[model samples]
Target: MSEDTNATDDRLRLLIERIERLEEEKKGIADDIRDVYMEAKAVGYDPKIMRQIVRLRKMKPDDRSEQDMLLDTYKNALGMA
Candidate 1:
């Protein structure tokens, strides 16, 4: 209709296209990470534990220690320590 409307439509289309491209890239990266985990499993490594370790590594050391302490406290309370 108007030039302003056309501009707005073009900008919206560009934004959507950019997001779609980024989503595709994210999926590709996730697949690559999955492949690496599969390779680790094939070589006898435990993927579940590996994932936990990766998650822990991303946390601060103090936070990790606090979490471990809380886990131990809960375990001791349950008499499963």
Candidate 2:
């Protein structure tokens, strides 16, 4: 193959290898998170609600407040309040 073609192939291979490494690292981190959640559950904490709390914590306060208001409105509409 031409030198330019070889260089392009090498770059592509390096990019793919980097992505694969990152994917494996991501999977390991996910497993670690799952283990933490399991530990929380063993300690009598609800993992589902824990996940929701984490998600809400990641959101801006205003955005979370808006979501809470909408949820309350919907619940009231359904006579769940």
Candidate 3:
């Protein structure tokens, strides 16, 4: 193969390897999160609510407030508030 072709192949291989390594690391982190949630459940906390709290915490405060307001508005409209 030409030198340029060989260089491109090496670059592609390196990128794929990096992505594979990152995917493995991501799986490990997810496992750790699952373990933590299991521990929380064992301690009498609801894992579902814990997950919701984690998700809400990741959102910007204004976005979260907006969502809460919209949820309340929907509930009120449904007469379920």
Candidate 4:
């Protein structure tokens, strides 16, 4: 291969390796989060609700309030609120 081709190949390989490493790290972080939830469950905390709270906390406050309003509207429409 030409030098330019070789360089391009090397760069591509490095990018793939970085992505693979990041994927492994992501998996490990997910496992750690799962363990924390399990521990919370053992101590009597509700993991599902905790996950929901975590998700909500990650959202913008205005977006979350809008979602809450929509959910409440839907529930009230269904007479389930």
Candidate 5:
């Protein structure tokens, strides 16, 4: 085989291996997230809202302020504000 072909094949192999490793890591992280949700539910906390709260907490302060404004708007619309 030519050097060019060998180089291309090596690149393809490396890309495939990297993708496979990332996929496996993703699955493990997903399973861990699911386990955390189950544990939260067992402890009487709503997992869905807990997840949303965690996500919001990770946002920048400016982004969180915007989210808070929207939430307040929603509450006012529902006459709960």
Candidate 6:
């Protein structure tokens, strides 16, 4: 019974370590993506709109379509048609 407990503890510790490592990796990737966005902005690209496009792409298709419709409507209202 004691051996079983020790084995379980070891497994839990390993899993936790793996999760922590993955979280750190995710943070690094997010930072890298942010850096790319900054570079794009420096090149005269609109980072805010670029980020919105990227975020919309990650959403469900239905949601993306709805957002697109709303944006088009707004643009038309603003005479940017």
Cα RMSDs of all predictions? 0.8, 0.6, 0.7, 0.8, 1.7, 3.5
Better structure of 2 and 3 per TM-score: 2
The candidate with the higher TM-score, 2 or 4, is 2
For 1-78, candidate 6 gives per-residue lDDT tens digits of 699999999999999999999999999999999999999999999999998889877999998889889999999999
Q: List the residue pairs that clash in candidate 4.
A: none
Best by TM-score: 2
CA deviation > 4 Å runs, candidate 5 = 77-80
What candidate 1 gets wrong by more than 4 Å, as runs, is: none
Model 2, CA-based lDDT: 0.99
lDDT, candidate 2, residue 71? 99
Q: Quick one: RMSD of model 3?
A: 0.7
Residue-by-residue lDDT tens digits, candidate 2, 1-81? 999999999999999999999999999999999999999999999999999999999999999999999999999999999
Q: Which stretches of candidate 6 lie over 4 Å from their true place?
A: 68-81
Please report how far candidate 4 places residue 19 from its true position, in Å.
Answer: 0.7
* Alpha-carbon lDDT, every model: 1.00, 0.99, 0.98, 0.99, 0.96, 0.95
TM-scores for candidates 1 onward, in order:
0.95, 0.97, 0.96, 0.95, 0.83, 0.75
- C-alpha positional error of residue 32 in candidate 1 after TM-score superposition, expressed in Å: 0.4
lDDT of 2 at 76: 100
Question: Candidate 4 lDDT, tens digit per residue, 1-81?
Answer: 899999999999999999999999999999999999999999999999999999999999999999999999999999998
What C-alpha lDDT, on a 0 to 100 scale, does residue 31 get in candidate 2?
A: 100
List residue ranges in candidate 4 displaced over 4 A: none
Stretches of candidate 2 off by over 4 Å are: none
Write candidate 5's Cα lDDT for 1-81 as tens digits: 999999999999999999999999999999999999999999999999998899988999999999899999999999998
